[model samples]
Target: MEFKNAKEARQKIREGMWTKPTPGLAYGYTQANLVVLPYKYALDFFIFCQRNTKPCPILDVCEPGKYTPIVTAPTGDIRSDIPKYRIYKNGNLVEEVTDIKKYWSEDLVSFLLGCSFTFEKALEDANIPIRHIEENKNVPMYITNIECKPAGMFNGPMVVSMRPMPKDLVQKAIDVTSRFPQVHGAPIHYGDPKKIGIEDINKPDFGDSVTIKEGEVPVFWACGVTPQAAIMRVKPDFVITHSPGHMFITDIKENDLALF
Candidate 1:
């Protein structure tokens, strides 16, 4: 299920042709995390993202009642562009669907947040293996003890995605990813997941665990899913988000986001 470009990939997803995780598709293009909330909570969530840029770098924010991410993927519909979506009501997950058109409303605001997946092409180019991708599984994610800077009613433990790479490539991976700060920059921690309150590296709070090969260390990065943690804690009345590992592919090229 390879595609020529981001648009094609998005179309496939839009038409229900692809429902799996989006990692290996649309290579070299930027991918994003989705967060749709009511107009009332939009401001608070935006502030939360501003105060916690590492885990919630915003790529584009649609106007209230809008679904198009004009800046990143103008032709795309946030309601169906993502392969999968999660619906939450009063903090409880109510359903997982392929599209949210039925849930659309004028009071809803959609946000496209920078995703670590955006930098994976840079990582692959550097020859640093992405373990979960290699294993055909979702990247392992954990909710850390580190609390994000509180903003309004939004605050919770930071969530991080892990990629197990050889000990030797750790520095190289950091150097490569550091150039793309808009997509979570670089590895925040490596070697010990316990230091971040992960009691079991084999069991992640979100996504799937992968093989941490011999001589490989688990590298962690700030994840956009951090907002979901806050949503659950705050128990907002209604919200929608892309399922973990499933992302919205954007028209922007991956290299375009690099600081270098």
Candidate 2:
């Protein structure tokens, strides 16, 4: 069944009909990265996102003990709206679950972070190719030497998602993406991966690496998955986040969140 909007998509996911990545699900709506942490780490994590807005742009934050995001989707349930989730214990990924109802807690605070999928439709409308979508795989991502500013207990290297494109279209890609600053606007770096400390362009730290066609360059953008890196480094007692490529569908439209 084709969903008419983000709300419908979330309903299907919540109903267990969808348990996969949410790249192109709600075509014209904004998608988000899910991050749930104990209240003890809430203030610090909030600061971490504020300090590193490019990769961790805040879409909406649910108050402690609240499971629904009043700002993004008042009717949506964070614990089940996403297709899949990753549970981290003491910084180690312990399991991947479809529903998080069994892990809910009053001390847990949920953060909805802006995701790049929100700008993908713009790219497609602009005729820019999305290699990962074309290949039906997750976008290639890497941990760069670039360091994000630390906030309280959270700190780690910046992680970036890469897309390959013709040299001439690089500028167009940038212009289209720049319109959505709330969703990690624009490519942070393009061309040489090694310069960014990516030892191998073929081996991504997360997601699957796609082909860089002849005469095409790899363009890197700040990725929402970056928080996972911080989580691993900090090893908080408990954390729940959308598995890479799995996102939370929201009711907000793409243009509603566009800066543009």
Top candidate by TM-score: 1
Per residue, candidate 2 scores C-alpha lDDT tens digits across 1-260 of: 56899888999999999987877788889999999999999999999999999999999999989998999998999999898999999999999999899999898999999999899999999999999989988888899999999999999999999999999999999999999999999999999999989999999998897988999999999999999999999899999999998899888999887766
Instruction: Supply the TM-score for candidate 1.
Output: 0.99
Question: Model 2 misses residue 153 by how many Å?
Answer: 0.7
Full-model lDDT, candidate 2 = 0.93
Model 1 misplaced regions, further than 4 Å: none
Global Cα lDDT for candidate 1: 0.93
Residue 143, candidate 2: Cα error in Å is 1.2
| Predictions in order: lDDT | 0.93, 0.93
1-260: candidate 1 lDDT, tens digit per residue: 89999999999999999999988789999999999999999999999999999999999999999999999998999999899999999998999999999999999999999999989988998899988888999888999999999998899999999998899999999999999888899979998888999999999999998998888899999999999999899999999999999999999999999999
Error of 1 at 114 (Å): 0.5
